[model samples]
Target: MKRLWGILCIMVCCTGELSAQKAAGFKGWFINNVKIANSMRTLDLSEQPAQLQLTFPRYQAHSYLVNMGIAVILNNNTTLNYISDLNVEYHRNTLTDAEQNNFSAGYGFKWRFANAGAADYFMAGDLQYLYNELNATNSLGGTFLLTLFRDGKRLNWNTNNFRLNNRLLFNLAPFAGFQMQEILKSRQNGMAGFILRPEFSINTSLAFCKKAGPPYDKLLAIFCNYTGRDDAINTTSFKEHYTQLLHTGINYYLAYSPFEVSIGASFNDGSDPLNGRTQQQYWQVSVNFLK
Candidate 1:
């Protein structure tokens, strides 16, 4: 009995030490989002002009999305470190009049070089590629964004393992950024033009569950994004421009061993004029696998 007890004590100590080491090393997560929605109304193809006649179905709108990316923790020395994130999202929207598909991928890196007792100084840049296919119309484009922030740090209450601890409390990342969009193709009255955009975004979250005591297990987040783009004509000089829509969404995440699932919904105003003014609402579900 004495020999057995001694072995058990040694094993417990070893496990504790290993856990501590893991907590101290570089931590990262890869996540994905997939979703589907249905439209609230259907267009009347039999009408004189084939106008869109709104009708409520069992489901309002459906959307599918897949976003997979990894974020790395550089260091934890002084709460100031470098972080990098690479993400890609694929979205498909089926509407009463048309079906739209978009693929977007971007990589971003941020540096937290200084924390002036109350605020953190950070700078980030991201480059994204977008491919959009609208029914018979096809458009290819890309965007480059740059942001600078002096955000105050607070405790993040959300418990999701995919998110960092300081994500929920009272942190504010008030940032200003610029985005440039370049269109590559135009067919079926597609808009192929360049736009200079200014954007602002906010991220907030709530903690729901705890897993390993220190790290949370589940989280809920509210994020808002707004972009304003200036019109730039194409080679054909077709005056095609509209104010970009504002987007707001809520997200929830449940973290498991090597995988996690996220669910979210987003609302956006009309950006393009199909027949008249049109608005879009999207609901999404995503599953992520980490290596």
Candidate 2:
């Protein structure tokens, strides 16, 4: 970790210089944020969910990116499962002269879950191809995720593994590692960079409903992760500094059919120190829709 800090320190000191060499855009946000907290288990495999289906995100053309993609989970059973997705994206230039269209595909398998410990686990690999109008670039990447706890909402895959009774108060365990993360990125004009920073989030599902239901619904969450792996822990004080966002929102499930649709919106407080030594604070709106 010491060596990691040393490299991150150099990057911080030369953040401005580094951007001059490459297009920072929103990518700079990743390097600016770094909070390293230890985590426990990982996995969230609930058989109660839709066994298999096609999934897609809200298509927002107004985004810095106007893109679309679809994903499929071949299985939700204990026997064997495989998944895949294909996405095409267009990145608009927020600064400098950078505009590109990208296409990427990824595949991965799910593990057979056991109730004993961390059960929701998945690992996947990807291949991305990018075209900047001038040149083409290709890169390879993968993701590894594990759920840290057994959600009180679902039965453990192996019921014998968990012998706990559920109560209303036992619901909220603050700072527990129930976060889901994915680091998605690709090379730019043949240059490698963070497409999406590694992110961690925590939230509850308490909502005002017309009928009695699970204690938690309408996905409530707050996530923090670096804008990039460009920096690591240098000083312990650095732990307290970095770019991160807090989101208060609701996820409304629209369907349980072959296709699932969900829409969510959040009031976001985006924080960063790149403007200077002090973190600049601002408020923005985040709306997400996935089908």
| CA lDDT, every model vs. true structure | 0.39, 0.30
User: For each candidate, how many residue pairs have backbone atoms clashing (under 3 Å)?
Assistant: 27, 20
* lDDT of predicted model 1: 0.39
Q: Give the Cα error of residue 175 in candidate 2, in Å.
A: 12
Query: Can you write out model 1's per-residue Cα lDDT over 210-266, one digit (the tens) per residue?
Result: 445545454665655444444443443344354554545555665545544455555
- lDDT computed for candidate 2: 0.30
Alpha-carbon error at 183 in model 1, in Å? Answer: 1.5
- Which has the greatest lDDT? 1
**TM-score list, all predictions:** 0.50, 0.39
Off by over 4 Å in 1: 1-88, 95-98, 105-107, 113-117, 135-171, 188-190, 219-255, 262-279, 282-291
